[model samples]
Target: MQGDVGFAQQILSLNLVPRKRLSSCGNDTSLCDFSEMWYGVILWTAVSSLIFHLPAALLALFTLRRHKVARFMPIAILLMGIIGPLTGGVLTSAAIAGVYKAAGKTMISLEALVFGVGQSFCIFVISFLRILATL
Candidate 1:
């Protein structure tokens, strides 16, 4: 979770255009401001989701070399890897929000939550594939 929080902070610091220019065009009845922020956010979520699970995926791949250890450990590791990040993201977001509140800032950081949910989606898809593989 800490790692994920750090990663999010790094991304935030990049000052990406979409994120940096949120809802800039204010209340023009005729003009439509369809910002591509959603696209950037989606891209970020997808990439980060894969990256967050890369370690577990690598470990699972390596464990495949051993017969006995390979049987269940890989799947368990993958599942736990997915779950740990989700919980970590939630807790980290909350902690950061608390800190901001204490500092008299009204900002609420949801990057951790977004990253966690994105990774959770990846895990669900993988688990579904595994189920299909068994059948």
Candidate 2:
């Protein structure tokens, strides 16, 4: 949940369009201005959601065999969960850059996405540590 919060905060803080542009668009009757922004956001949400769950998905598939691998499952999950997002940061940043670049966007910073990805990873590790501690 906390990892999700970091991601949400990161995405929410992004200004898809400058307030000046948004104000002008608001005055216009056409929805194109705001619609474009929502499109970018939706793209980000979709990519992030898929990337974040990748580790879990992989673990589930591997664990289904329930053989020798079962003994190392916990360690594998922990390592993969940690490493997955670390690698994801680069991919996320690149994807975000591509989307914004295509949009000719100047308002939003890709750095925010990078930071958000990092924070999400931190939150993931922290949450996992907390869970492990409780046990």
Candidate 3:
């Protein structure tokens, strides 16, 4: 049973790997290149998670400590991370809408910016969640 669980975890980890193929950078290369590529990828994932996401998650968790369930912290971080940008954009837009309205120039609407950011943010957060699940 334990072995089965380990196998399932391994499968999940393998599935989480990006499907994009990377060509070898050198001629006459062997497993070393392939191994190195995956090593670099894993290292990059860890480094990015630590550098970009961890602090945000920590801040979200800290803020949520007052009014949230512990398990909801991760979801809260994802939501807060997204909402923070969107809210800022909305506030800025409300401030600038009049200027744009008067200028009659081409500029993205605040709703468009918020929606675009939200869609991209969801993809990013899902990928991070997958990475965490593997770990």
Steric overlap count per candidate:
0, 0, 0
Give lDDT for model 1: 0.48
Q: Could you give candidate 3's per-residue lDDT for residues 78-129 as a string of tens digits?
A: 6654564355434433444444445643232223234334444554688679
lDDT order of candidates, top first? 2, 1, 3
Q: Regarding TM-score, does 1 or 3 come out ahead?
A: 1
Report the Cα lDDT for residue 24, model 2.
Answer: 44
Runs in model 1 deviating more than 4 A are 1-53, 106-135
Candidate whose TM-score is highest: 1
- Which regions in candidate 2 have their CA more than 4 angstroms from the true location? 1-46, 65-108
Give the clashing pairs for model 3: none
C-alpha RMSD by candidate, in order: 12.1, 13.5, 18.3
User: If both were scored by lDDT, which would come out higher, candidate 1 or candidate 2?
Assistant: 2
Q: Write the per-residue lDDT of candidate 2 for residues 12-42, one digit (tens) a residue.
A: 5555533334444333222233344434433
Task: Assess the local accuracy of residue 74 in candidate 2 as a C-alpha lDDT between 0 and 100.
Answer: 52
User: What TM-score, over all chains together, does every model reach?
Assistant: 0.37, 0.34, 0.31
